[model samples]
Target: MRGKKLADLNVMERIAQEDDMGTMTKDESAQFKADRQAAQAKYGQMSAEEKAAVRKAAQQKRLSDLNTMERVGQENDMRRYMSY
Candidate 1:
């Protein structure tokens, strides 16, 4: 696995790639920090109810995007969990 290219990784291996912080490139880290700051600024401007609504809407959209197997896995509390 040490010498394997990203394209050669399996589905679970590809998914696990996100768990390795060293995998992030400098540009990706900068972009992620920028995005997070923007989201934090936006959230800080929202009221309590507005925040709840926004979170609910995002959850709904995420659930809708999942396929049957993923949804079923979620319902069953599988090892592979979805994140927001």
Candidate 2:
């Protein structure tokens, strides 16, 4: 797990990596499953335009997060150089 990227991990391995307790409580797991099913049902009822909008929004959010991460890395490098 040390050198493995998230995409390289299998589903259970990824879940293990993300969950510090290594497993969810039974109630929490049940709630999560119900939420997922609900979301799937809602999405299934959405029109194609709505689905595309959702995907576009998600893509935009990912791009925004990537930009923020890159900016933070650059700032960290600047701070390190300035301290030298």
Candidate 3:
């Protein structure tokens, strides 16, 4: 895994890349901080209904992404088992 490129990593591998704070690179941490600040700024100006909508949309997107990641993980597992 040390010499592998990001493109070569499967979904699970990519996700595991940021498993903990100690594993996160400085650039990744900076980008994550910037993104969070931007999201907070955007949310701060929204009306009540707009905030609710945004929250709901965020939840849905999170769930969808998790489902997709899970499916990819399952596919990877199946492939590994099939090679046995």
Model 3, 4-62: lDDT tens digits are: 99999989999999787567889999999999999899889899989777766765565
**Residue 34 of model 1, lDDT score:** 100
Instruction: State which candidate has the highest TM-score.
Output: 2
Question: What would the per-residue lDDT of candidate 2 be over residues 1-84, giving only the tens digit for each residue?
Answer: 779888899999987877766677999999999999999999999999898788777755654666666867666554543342
* Runs with alpha carbons beyond 4 Å of true place in candidate 1: 1-28, 76-84
Ranking by TM-score: 2, 1, 3
Say which candidate scores most in lDDT.
1
- Model 3, C-alpha of 7: deviation from truth (Å): 31
Clashing pairs in 1: none
Residue 55, model 2, lDDT:
77
TM-score of 1: 0.52
Measured against the true structure, the TM-scores of the candidates, in listed sequence, are 0.52, 0.56, 0.42
True-vs-predicted CA distance for residue 29, candidate 3, Å: 0.5
Query: Which regions of candidate 2 are displaced past 4 Å?
Result: 1-21, 68-84
In model 1, state the lDDT of residue 83: 40
Which wins on TM-score, candidate 2 or candidate 3? Answer: 2
